[model samples]
Target: MPLVHIDLIEGRSEEQLRQMVRDVTDAIVKNTGAPAEHVHVVLNEMKKNHYSVGGVLKSDEK
Candidate 1:
């Protein structure tokens, strides 16, 4: 089994997230030779305020 963790700023639609999971899982299965059913993808969405770049919070920048 393969476990994939993806983190990004929250904003994607349900469909987008679903597609993302599917694509990532497919890639993992292809690269690791794992079965599709055994591939797991976990998405973690973070608030803009929780992410910082160059010492500046995303929420505070714009």
Candidate 2:
């Protein structure tokens, strides 16, 4: 089984997230020769305040 985890900031449309999962899963299946049913993808949405870069929170940057 292959497990992929993706983390991103919130606010993406449902379709975008769905497409992302599909594309990522497809890529993993193609690259790793994994079965579609055995490939698992998990998406984690983080609050702006929970992420930071360059000493600034994402919420503050925006």
Candidate 3:
């Protein structure tokens, strides 16, 4: 089994998320020779207020 962890800021559409995971799974399977059924994708969505860059929170960005 192959496990993949993806962390991103919240607000993406469900379909976008689904497509992202599908593409990731396909890449993992292609590179590692892992079966598609055995690939594990874990998505961690961080709140805009909880994520920051250069001392500014994502939620506070214009």
Candidate 4:
């Protein structure tokens, strides 16, 4: 089994997330020859305030 973990700042629509997982699964299957059913995708969505870059929180970005 192949496991993929994706983390993103929370803002994307459900359809976008779904499409991303599908595309990722396809890529994994094509590259590793793993069955689609055996590919696992885990998505972690963090609140903007919970994410930071260069000491600035995403929610505080101007």
Candidate 5:
């Protein structure tokens, strides 16, 4: 089985997130020849305030 992990900031619509996972799964399946049922996807969503860049929290960005 192949595992794919993904992370993104919170707030995307369910459909959008679903599409993203599907795309990742498709890519992995095509490249690795893994069966779709055997591929595992993990989606990690964090709050904007929990992530930072340049010492500024993502929630604080303009």
Candidate 6:
């Protein structure tokens, strides 16, 4: 089994997230010969205020 973890800032539509996971799974299957059912994808969405860069929170930037 192959496990893939993806982290992104919150706000994407449900459909977009679903498509992202599907695309990831397809790539894994194509490259590693993993079965579709054996590939696991985990998506972690972070709030803008919870993510930061250059000492500034993303929510504070814009």
TM-score of each: 0.92, 0.93, 0.96, 0.98, 0.95, 0.96
Q: For this target, which candidate reaches the highest lDDT against the unseen true structure?
A: 4
RMSD of each: 0.9, 0.8, 0.6, 0.3, 0.6, 0.5
Across residues 5-49, which tens digit of lDDT does each residue of candidate 3 receive? 999999999999999999999999999999999999999999999
Per-model lDDT: 0.92, 0.94, 0.97, 0.99, 0.94, 0.96
Return the candidate ranking by TM-score, descending.
Answer: 4, 6, 3, 5, 2, 1
The residue-level lDDT of candidate 2 at 43 comes to: 95
Q: 1-62 in candidate 4: lDDT tens per residue?
A: 99999999999999999999999999999999999999999999999999999999999999
Which window of ten consecutive residues has the lowest lDDT sum in model 2?
53-62
**Ordering by lDDT:** 4, 3, 6, 2, 5, 1
What number of clashing residue pairs does each candidate have, in the order they appear?
Answer: 0, 0, 0, 0, 0, 0
After superposing candidate 2, which stretches have Cα over 4 Å from the reference?
none
Steric clash pairs (candidate 3):
none
Residue lDDT tens for model 2, 1-62: 99999999999999999999999999999999998899999999999999999989999984
Report clash pairs, candidate 6. none
Best by TM-score: 4
Off by over 4 Å in 5: none
Clashing pairs in 1: none
Question: How many backbone clashes are present in model 2?
Answer: 0
Which TM-score value belongs to model 2? 0.93
- Give candidate 4 misplaced runs (Cα > 4 Å): none
Better of 1 and 6 by lDDT: 6
Evaluate model 6: give its lDDT.
Answer: 0.96
